[model samples]
Target: MAKESSHAVHAAGAHRVVVIVDENSNPFELGCATEIFGLRRPETGRDLYDFRLCSPEPRTLMRDGFFTLTGVAGLEAADAADTLIVPNRPDTDVPRRPAVLDAVRRAHARGARLVGFCSGAFTLAEAGVLDGRRATAHWQWADSFRARFPSVHLESDVLFVDDGDILTAAGSTAALDLGLHMVRRDYGAEIANSVSRRLVFAAHRDGGQRQFVERPMPDLPDESLAPVLAWAQERLDSPLTVSDLAARAAVSPATLHRRFRAQLGTTPLTWLTGERLALACRLIERGESRFEVVARRSGIGTAANLRTLMRRETGISPSAYKARFGPQTNG
Candidate 1:
């Protein structure tokens, strides 16, 4: 989805993503969607999603009347979306528009992807679409959401919950995390990396991570793993172990594990494996046909191991991924 968007960005082959904004809606989360899906990315020099914004009324007063937004698309635009983002509001108690709720229900019935950023989860729940599905919202709204929709499984502590087609984010910053995650799902790790770099943001934060830090963070530079992470990324094809990373960071393996848990919300082995798998994906999407070559080049050990890991992580075989995202060739 590559398009220069002022209000409506158009790209013929890109996935269409539309955001619905309503009265008292928070513009920050709306802007997060625009930045991730709407804006043209100069990083990969391609657009990842064809994006648009819509409102139920001509002039909707934003959260606290911070601004009155106008001149965007109408609520009917929700019907055309490959993915529909419900209105995100700060005042969780304020009732969502029936039009918005109906749009969400229609989108759900049609199997279009649905997203709820921050308190937008309430909108989805009220629409009756989030029932029996795992979701999350701003932690502060957790109690209220559960009390209102006891049928919906609400996990408030995580950054976001990805329950297949329907997803929800925890807070405003988590909105960015979920957006980049969606980009990663639609495109690939490489494109998502480029976009994250352009945004100057962390590339990946697993959705299972806590919304708030549980422990005191150690100061960077004095005992930072950035240098070691950089070193390992450059040499992923090498036979490196947790001990190797620990040694490079000038810390014991136990200490390194603790830091990875506290700082990155993941273990060292998982992070390393994900990086290697991402490298394999990049190689395959770039036209590497030999599975053995991809495995060796990505330090995934062997072709069988590569296939196993690929299926476990991405739920697709390398060949299937190539067929979906690979460069096209004409006969």
Candidate 2:
């Protein structure tokens, strides 16, 4: 994990987040926790989380003396955090202290949401928090993870799997995606989008982390589809189709379908509709104040269709969503 600098703002909010670390900790994953939950987002006019690092013991070297961390809180801190994160471990079979696993189990038993980043799935599995839950980890560790934890429904193809209270991220940076999703779930889309913009990260991703998984190269030379995706995004208000995408990419429809499946893990139409719906959500939250206008602008076809889609996707009407997440004015 590259060390990215972050600036803090006014601290606010009551949600407490604690990250659990061990001797074999991965710095990048630790950094992910600190970067996402620890930072104070001034743009939102308040800090999001009361974030800290907790260890079974005090202070340890991370990643073979890459750096030493000090002044870390102990397992008692996990008792107070609303969210508990276990960062990536160096090895799948590394011996873990019983106290660390006990702290994790106790944290989950008391209703703290448990999150495993990258190889941290191992720690969670050992703690038995993921026994019957849908979870995921970095692709490189999938086989070992599956072999060790047969009770877990391993979603090796996704960037992260969110099964309510138990969330697992695939790799180091996929933590960003999961963290943004948490913010969205806790605060609202408006706040999540603001944090993503400040980080200069993708506000929305097309598909799973399967695209990052290594595989044998196909016989045909594959060109990047990012440009075509960007072009489609610019004109999302207009109708888009598989044939249209093929033409834009200068490739046959069959080739486009194959590319979409291999690169994005979803069909082109699904990806396009997801993008359109994402836009609809943002526009609605930005105080659009009219479903008809938002639908037309987001290319969802009709206001009735927008209402149906919003209800089906979010279990809330457009009006209800706006009521909850629409622009806020500070008195």
After TM-score superposition, the amount by which residue 108's alpha carbon in candidate 2 deviates from its true location, in angstroms, is: 1.9
TM-score of 2: 0.84
Candidate 2: C-alpha lDDT: 0.78
Top-scoring candidate (TM-score): 1
Model 1 spans > 4 angstroms off: 1-12, 42-47, 214-217, 329-331
Model 2 residue 200 lDDT score: 90
**Residue 193 in model 1: shift from native, Å?**
2.0
Candidate 1 lDDT, 1-331, residue by residue in tens: 1111111223456689999999998989988898888888755656568789999999989998899999999999999998899998878887888998999999988878899999999999999988888999998888999999999989988899887788899977899999988887777777888888878998888788778763546676667668899999999999989999999998999999988887777789988998899899888878888999999999899999998998877667888777655665201
Tens-digit lDDT string for candidate 2 (1-331): 1111111122355589899877868988888788889888888876678898987767787888887788989778888778889756767788578888888899877777888888888889998888888888988888998999999999888888767678788876688888887776666677888888887986755325452623234445545677899999999889888899999999998988778777666678878887888788888777798889999999898999999988765556888777666775211
Give me the displacement of residue 99 in model 1, in angstroms.
0.9
**Against the true structure, what is each candidate's TM-score?**
0.89, 0.84
